[model samples]
Target chain A: MNTLKINYKNIYYPPGGILMWIIIFLELITFGMALVAFVYYGNEQRELFHHSRMQLNTTFGAINTVFLLTSGFFMANAVHQFKEKEIQKSSVFFKLAMLGGFLFLGLKSIEYYHKIESGISLDTNMFYTFYWLLTGFHVIHVIMGLVILGWTNYGMTKKDSDTITEDVEACAAFWHMCDLIWLLLFPVLYLIF
Target chain B: MQKSLIFVYGVLIALTIATALIANFMLVSPFVVSLIMGLAVFKFSLVTFQFMELKKANSFWKVSLTLTLGLIVLLIIFLK
Candidate 1:
């Protein structure tokens, strides 16, 4: 009879191993959907899909890839510093990674603005549809990373090392996952065209 | 300061610049672009596994991640 009465927050707070599994599950689903879109495009109108892909701005894709890889490096540094018990330096790296995420969002928005100005949009065609869906979904994850980093920053100022270390590791894992996804995406979406 | 770390960083930066130039000016063949991208992935894996100390992570976690990547790559090939 477990009567310790854990709070709702405790159940939800990440770095709880269960939450990592849940995040992995969600990632698998997104990856599956993207795969399905690719297959569908393959069967229906392959040439149109290839033609539409050329309309994408590869320069922006390359820039975003660089930004994501930089963010992952900072995140790795943050976790490394956390293990070293240098909380202040870890926090700095975390903030740097967060800044990288913001820079990515800024570049993505600029790309989107030009896209919209050129009269292209989500529903314009299958290629644009997958383009917006996949990239937009990634942007949402980047925003979530920012929010988590903001909270982790607050924790860094107040919490003990063990707690903060856990948070930093979890966020680093998520950030690295973001970086990995973009690695695949950059080649598939941009270079392939 | 480990020389290996510095050497790895130098290679990563060089590869990055090279990839950008190839994408922009050279317009290399798709196979070469993929080769460059694959190298980038390898670089990042080294950074994550060795530099970040994930090399000793639980086997289950590593296997799962690798499987996910494999599946995703297969799907992308089918797309092409």
Candidate 2:
């Protein structure tokens, strides 16, 4: 039993849990399926897609991409620091990560405001339909990730290293999912034109 | 962990800039869209392998996730 215990300590398993991977798998398929549908429709209406795509502001999308990537970077660092037994440093990095998320949301809101003010509603066109659904869905995930990160930040204040580790790892996984989804979306919606 | 993760992020940020430049400044070309989408796939790999800590996980995990990403990229390419 003692030998088994010592061996278990050295094994590096995935952070978070296996079920989170399952969820990630499912979530990615759902988005991919949706994107495929978008691509099909866009291909059928290539001219319309081209016209509507021009209405979008790549500048905002590019900036938001940076925001999310920076957030993901900080989140990875947060997990690393947490593993190193630096609770205070981990919390600081997590806060910075959250700040990036919030900034992305703020900029996204502005982008939405401009789109709405320009009279571009969800029903404006087929391309807009996919745009609202895909990006709005992503925004919801970002919100959910922020909430989880908030709880993870609170967990770091406690003295229990074991639970803190799990919380941080799980939070990092979820946040990175957000980043990954955005990577797919940015190229499809903003960069394809 | 810190140094390697930082390096991954640096590469990712640089790729982000490259994608933007290619998409915005480059004129219309048959291969442009393919290149942009390819960068997305590369970025996805970095995020999965480095940030998601899949690099330390079992091979089964890495392979399955990569296959899934590949399938998605293929679907996009077919339509593009």
Candidate 3:
């Protein structure tokens, strides 16, 4: 019987690996600074921000939030099942996670289509500049996350597979980073002004 | 473990809906923004600790993540 081993006491070996955590921190900080800048500019042009924010669809944003959070839940479960040596169950969860990601992208694409059709662009206004840049960047991350999950899922389910707990954990950490970033972005972009 | 994961998922979905409702139905104001952001922060912590498995991580990682989130939230509130 194979069992996963991790040193919880070791700061250098946090869950999903130290390197992944470092990347997570760096990503968080990068997004955090952008959010701060968004708020600063939002305050500078209060009416513009408010009016532009009104143009956004909170319903789509809210639905996307649910999508990503549910995806993150499936991802965590995938990792948990992997650790339990339930490879088939883990694969099923991985597929479900990817499905959630796809649904988010689908909804986001529809939203983006509406915005573009309405002639909203990055140069539209202060509020929209932040909107396009932040949400566009986040969409790229979701696409990348889906790709990673695809590769990881393939590796885990293939014949003579060598996928390990660390691999799934690292993939999950990356996916959840997308969730975390959206958690920050959704409120600031779609809800709060 | 499955039970706990489902519980967390339910809480996350509930909070997401609550935040959206507060933002949509209520008038936009500093107080409303604060409440919404507060819920965002709480949801953020839930995902970080529970979904990301940071709960099982070193105290250093946990504290650093929490502090970073706090700083970001403070900045948003203060600047907004």
Candidate 4:
């Protein structure tokens, strides 16, 4: 008689582990609630929201979306390479992912500069308030993700590298969270009123 | 696996472009808004299931995330 063996880790722990999944869930819920509120207020002041949204550059938003998505793809590839034991290739992909993050920040900074030059701030209006708060928080997340990726890449470079699969998976998960949040934010803030 | 990843990425980019075109060129209507939101949800799912490897995860995570996204989209549409 053959007994089936179960890998409990596969059953309970996700790609990045249980703890990271918890963080992702909480973050998603928080952002979802904020988006719902933004929509509610948008309905209340339709014209203001429309006008405020018009102040945004859709091209920049679209480009940024591409940036994050590309970065996410690269990060996924990095994890794949790492799992395949191609550490050098994984590091290259990691760098590419970081490049995407940097491009996103660069474009976002330009957009922010334009807004600040035009005297737009968190208190500018309800729409701008949501804009700043939501996107600003997201930018912070991207920055944190980049730092995590950078550290993970550095670890990969050491002769006796101690970077484990779980650590790399956690980093990728966090980076993808940034991508996921931006995916939600880009449309509501840029395309929709 | 790499081919599959590439396919997913292609689909995502195409969807993103379609969304932009619809929003920029088409007249604003209930249908248009719904379409854009729907596309956004589709893109989100691709990233979550494919890039984030949620497809390999347990059913609980998959179901809960799907429900969470659905709820968020419904609330936005209802409120809007």
TM-score of chain A of each: 0.83, 0.91, 0.98, 0.95
Docking class of 1: incorrect
Per-candidate DockQ vs. reference: 0.20, 0.59, 0.82, 0.66
Of the pair 3 and 4, which is ahead by DockQ?
A: 3
Per-residue C-alpha lDDT of model 3 across residues A19-112, encoded as one tens digit per residue: 9899999999999999999999999998999899999999999999999999999999999999999999999999999999999999999999
- By DockQ: ranked, best first: 3, 4, 2, 1
Fnat, one value per model: 0.10, 0.60, 0.84, 0.59
RMSD of each: 6.4, 3.2, 1.0, 3.3
lDDT string, candidate 2, A32-138, tens digits:
99998998898899889989998999989988999999999999998877777777898899999999999999999999999999999899999999999999999
lDDT, residue B77, model 1: 51
lDDT of 2 by residue, B1-80 (tens): 47888899899989999998998898645488889989999999999888877877777778888999899888887887
lDDT of candidates 1 onward, in order: 0.67, 0.86, 0.92, 0.91
Ranking by lDDT: 3, 4, 2, 1
TM-score, every prediction: 0.80, 0.93, 0.98, 0.96
Number of the predicted model whose DockQ against the real structure is largest: 3
Model 3: residues with Cα > 4 Å off, grouped in runs: none
lDDT of 3 at A18: 89
Best by lDDT: 3
For model 2, the stretches where C-alpha displacement exceeds 4 angstroms are A1-13, A159-162
DockQ metric, candidate 3:
0.82
